[model samples]
Target: MIIRNLADRNKKGADTEVVDGQQRLTTIYEFTQGGFSINDELSKRIVRDNSDSYEFDIANNAGKETEAIKFYKKFKKGQKVSLTYGTLSSLMKADFDSYNMALTYISHHDDNVIAEYFRFVQNQERLRAGEIINSIPDSLLEQYLMQVDSKSLLFKLSWEDKRKEFDKLFYAAIGIFDEKLPLGGVDSDIIEYVKNSAGIAGRALERTNLLITQLQALSKDETWNFSSGINKRFVKFLCMLCGYGYVDFSKNPKEKLQQLFVVNKKLSAFSSAKATALSNEFVGYTEEQIENYRLIALISKGSQKWDMVEERMRLLAVLMNEVKI
Candidate 1:
């Protein structure tokens, strides 16, 4: 009954998009458009009142005050009266476009607020039961990355529009895989590893909230340091090394990083001895050195062409195999 009244109100120029009760609104719309007669007495009463008020407004808009009397007489005789309804399809399209544009503008203006708003909406009781379950993951991912320190080297190396790409790459490097990736023993291992490295497991879980914000900012051709650039391949390889439980060997982390410069120079020579040097160096490198090694790995894997990121990964895999042997 309420749905019918709302539909009638919509026909009379009232705004009714059903942000909260879309299913109900849709059913009402179908009934109204399909010319289903309302048997609910309460619904009939509301519709009648609303329709009468709307007809009066239409008559006034048409400047048919005098003709209204004639129409009322015809209406009494059961004549069908034509009332102008607003162009609903066009209005809906405009509303959708306006909403999307507003979201885009808001995200650009203040991503943190946008992320918070999405978080709030997703947690709403009414929303949790909806068919849009996948949207939650996306929203959480976005919120997580937006909170990452913008001053970080990772952010500095990433393109603004490719935050989502970077987020995905980071997650993959940390062994999160994709959405289909099972959250079993392997997932626990990966999560534990990240927590141990960052010294905060709870915070790491919370960071997944930023994924959506990053994806929303992506452009068709945009690239990120860890995904479509050299950094992507590097991080992946480094993560693999970390997965193997190699610890930094240097007393000072900074000095350990300097060792990577040495490794980089030797690797540039591409010799059997260089490979041996890499294994020896890997065993004793500091955590910071491991980080730099990851960067070098990315650089080694990257290409100027967008198509070459994957190729770089493939090439790095070959180099890693040879180095391991």
Candidate 2:
């Protein structure tokens, strides 16, 4: 369907008209613009005859003159146009109403999806004590705002561009920490631990600030190198290990992150040691072994019970170690 509106170029008054039927005006407009083809002769006749019948000739022709001329030449064999033209003003009001109705129908159908997206965007803001919180601290309820903001690292990390790598780091950190400390209850310490480790509060912010400084120290290419690919994995792993995992450096806050690099070195060593073992056991192994490796990796260092985590880790370690032989 198509509708065409005729309007005066000067914004003097309501000099607008609907040159064609409101239901079909858009379709006719599209057809005129070559977006669609009018295959039916009767529809073509209606379009050609309606313009002259209404005497509708305002500017913004919508290709009507050229289209009408083409249709007449092709179909009517150059017959004189026989439609009446109407005032552009009345046609415009009908066109506006029809367009609004179409939009209303579409919005009704998409209301749920629109609402969900809106909620997701709103949730990005931190909340505190039944109030929406802004990004800045110390506005009204500072302490509660800070607490909520600290806990929101998980959400932020989930949406990171390098999400999968962050997920692996998070799972691994939680796995290691849970094995050692065993989160028994939701206490202030647990909350503080999560906030501190995730770099959402206190020492975490300092650490992040330092990391950013170091990044700024490097050249653009070097900075890009650190941010890309497996480097991101390394960085996230370092953060997780230092923040939550089991690695005891001295009480010096500055050295805590250094300890994480040491743990990553250990993990690298472990991975290297297992690389040969993984090759031999899967000598004629199909892709299924590789698939199993990924599944096994998930449970290898997660919040599983000690026995389950150890078993999975042992199995993966063995598989990886025997791959070469």
Candidate 3:
């Protein structure tokens, strides 16, 4: 028997459907379940000597009282005839475990599996998160969104477009820093922000992209994968980048983005004691800056909560535009 797995099939929303050998398999299964009697054409001959045995009683031989009562009512009293195939021992003698079926499974994916294809393949027929985000119509924030090319070094870090990583990040950033709302954002929030956020989000993204581009160029880790939930090495930069609008950078942070590194190592890996101190003891930084770094560590612990997001972003924003090259 061959079975097909269909994803878009319309037959009662079934994920699987029969492809071949259904009639023969169904007949065999019925026979194994003591369903139908074998005609003389199927059997060699009738067992005439044991014709009176209950084993020859095909109608009620399935141990079904209802079928026996039905056959009794249909015929005259004690006139039911018992018939069995030649040398057939009994009626109920089937072992379900003795049968094993060989399956030849077929599906639409059989044709889709490119066994000898290239090193990489982008299936355009299936839309990815990046594609879905791009497909969104003109929105206020989308119009001001950063344009990261597919061929860019940053794009290469993610390799294949992860499902909704960028969408979540973009919406979360806008909702936190730009909207200044306590609620987290989703893809639809892109349009909502424009409808509601006066002009804050539009300006936030426009300015944030510039700083993002700067950090991308100055970062030492080539594969600084910043996508949500995985290798979020630079999320703090986003949380703090918007704060640059309220602060002055003429102070020329006594810190440095050594070897083209951008965010301070202490901020990147927080609260990890010596394991995270990037430039040795937050050295050369003033007491106010040191407090901000430690304060960020405390706030980041609860940053996933909506009420804490704005505060976290506000604190982290002070940390940006201070990476002295």
Candidate 4:
């Protein structure tokens, strides 16, 4: 049976509607009105049937009251049936068992997994906060805004993009320090610096916006698609590199963006042509390389990986050295 919105009868607004199976509904209604008659043998068999193998319940037999049987048939399938008495109260609640289950799962996962999950939760919080901030009045923002268009502008980070950033920071920190931290993603001083900040998520979004703005200002070339595939990943890596001081964004913004286009172009080709080779070659390299290689391997193996993030970041590190700042 299908349920639909009833026409606004009396202009009071509809509570519900039955979009299909009206004949069946009428038959059932008549059956209830007829007092649900059945043969005495069938009634005796139905009441006695208690086998678990049976699909339907036999307890609602011909002997049951018509009103009770009619009430019993109220619960139909689908969301339409459930909306008969919609409550505004919360339907879901977080409990200790869920927390414990998450904790248990995290305990078994590697540092990369932990870091990725942590960033995911943080990004969700950031998204909710961004929504609230965006809902606020522009006048209020103007009265209290400190940074340059920071409140007005916000960046969207997907789970994959955020994970890529986490991996980049993890590896870059390790490479810079030449020593592995206690936890690959979280124990780095660089990560700690960002973590201690008041607006860590906001800062990431702002920097990303800055990168996109600068890149767009450099050229209007539509040769590369920056919204999806490898091009977007390349842009994200450049943003991270600039954030980490690897790429001098201020020195030659135009030149850097041009380099990005070239590198992204090459990376795109390599991804399509030699994905497996790319994954294999990057093996036993830096943490960043290895992490990215794993992502490439996942892609090569036909797994639906997140947003070409690893491949793009890996290419950024590779091509950055060749491209003059």
Give each model's clash number.
Answer: 17, 42, 2, 0
**Could you estimate the TM-score for every candidate?**
0.23, 0.23, 0.34, 0.26
**Predicted candidate 1 versus true structure: per-residue lDDT over 1-325, tens digit per residue:** 0111132345658543323455655665564464343334443333233433324335445654433344334444554544211211221222222221101111111335444545656686434322322211333234344544533434434445544435544554333322222211132233334334432234234323332223223221133233234333333333323222232211232332233224444442222222243454466656454444444443443122222333433443433333321
**Top lDDT: which candidate number?**
3
Please report, as a residue range, the 10-residue window in candidate 3 with the lowest summed lDDT: 112-121
When sorted by TM-score, best at the front, the candidate numbers are 3, 4, 1, 2
Model 2: runs farther than 4 Å from truth? 1-160, 163-175, 178-283, 286-303
- 1 against 4, candidate with superior TM-score: 4
The lDDT per prediction is 0.35, 0.34, 0.42, 0.35
Better of 3 and 4 by lDDT: 3
Least well predicted 10-residue stretch by lDDT in candidate 4: 88-97
User: On residues 1-325, what C-alpha lDDT tens digit does candidate 2 reach at each position?
Assistant: 1111223432645333332246466664554355644345544455443333122222335556643344444444544333221221223223322232211111112335444534654576312311321111122212222332222333322334544334334333342334432212112223334434422445434433333333222212111222222343344444332333222222332243333333333333212223243344444766565445534533323234445543543444344334331
Candidate 2 global lDDT: 0.34
Give residue 11's lDDT in candidate 2 (0 to 100). 63
User: For model 3, which pairs clash?
Assistant: 240-316, 240-317
Choose 1 or 3, whichever is better by TM-score: 3
